[model samples]
Target: MLKQFGCTKFATGEDFDTGELFVQFEHRGRMVSLIASSKGYAAAWLKENPYNNRRKGTKADHEAKALEKGGTAVYSILRDWVKGQVTAIEIGMLSFESAFLSHILLPSGKRVIEHVEEQKLLEGK
Candidate 1:
């Protein structure tokens, strides 16, 4: 079945006044060229740090814990749930705002916005 996961928008140019916008999700992604409307303004935000690099053994510990979860683990369990289905997802303006709030511009000029929203699974066809 088709599912409405979540949404995210990626700024595609240095000029914030006008640029390309990318709407992304688990099943598909879209690029909305030419951002002209003020109502849909995009603001860059910071990336979420899932792990602490300064802390030793943190990465390893997290990986080890994830492995313990096994095939039926949290990640796998979620993956298995959406194994075979025509997922149709639609992201609204709210998600776009959230994504913009979590974006950060890189030194190389590319903007990175990670993990916009918590994944939501839908059942059926």
Candidate 2:
């Protein structure tokens, strides 16, 4: 879907130590990156699935499995989300910038959302 809409390249990276994953793509001459944390998702999943007593695994092994599951879940979620946003852009429901503003890279070598975070732009008044 992304290639159909002016995305020329796509790549992915992962950090097992940090449980972070990122995907980078070129869209309409601009580089956009999206990031997710397997640890964060795993934490959330653990909250919902607190009881793993029936599972036979050491603590570290359980954590490792959880992180792996989280990574898979996050990937699926990101795929669906990107497809939806691309569809929205394709159908004229949104502009590319509006659809992916947060993921869009800026000249400052940071994502737009990073700048927004530095400035606390989303903070409540």
Candidate 3:
């Protein structure tokens, strides 16, 4: 299964890391997960590999690599998936990039910014 999924050992931190982009399948009474990202290294390795698996080296190394590559990949995949799902549901022109860049209105009538605002208020101006 590992070979079929193009599984490779990542030299990550603290433990062995295995990245898998998997799909759930039912087999008899049990559920099976098949690696879908075997065909796409960047998708599977970059996105799903870091957090889902154990690291092989130090935590710092794992975190560094994950922060450098994993985070971006994960964000990309998640953004794409969200876009696809929302579009499928006929949500008009919802863009992940826009949401990431600007403020968005939530269903709760609250506005959320992609990044937090840090402001200091003076007692008297």
Highest lDDT against the true fold, candidate: 2
lDDT of candidates 1 onward, in order? 0.32, 0.87, 0.39
lDDT of 2: 0.87
Model 3 pairs in collision = 12-57, 13-57, 14-57, 15-55, 15-56, 16-55, 21-36
Tens digits of per-residue lDDT, candidate 2, 78-100, equal 88989999899889999999989
Q: Predict model 1's lDDT versus the native.
A: 0.32
Number of clashes recorded per candidate: 4, 0, 7
Q: What is the lDDT of residue 118 in candidate 2?
A: 100
Q: Cα miss at 72, model 1 (Å)?
A: 2.8
* TM-score, per-candidate, Cα-based: 0.18, 0.90, 0.26
Residue pairs with colliding backbones in model 1 are 1-125, 2-88, 3-88, 45-103
Residue 102's lDDT in candidate 3: 28
> Model 3: what TM-score?
0.26
> What is the Å distance of residue 120 in model 3 from its true position?
32
Name the lDDT of candidate 3.
Answer: 0.39
lDDT of 1 by residue, 41-106 (tens): 211111122346774567767444333333223333333333322131123324433333333333
Q: Which portions of model 2 miss their true places by more than 4 Å?
A: 51-53
Cα lDDT, model 3, residue 31: 28
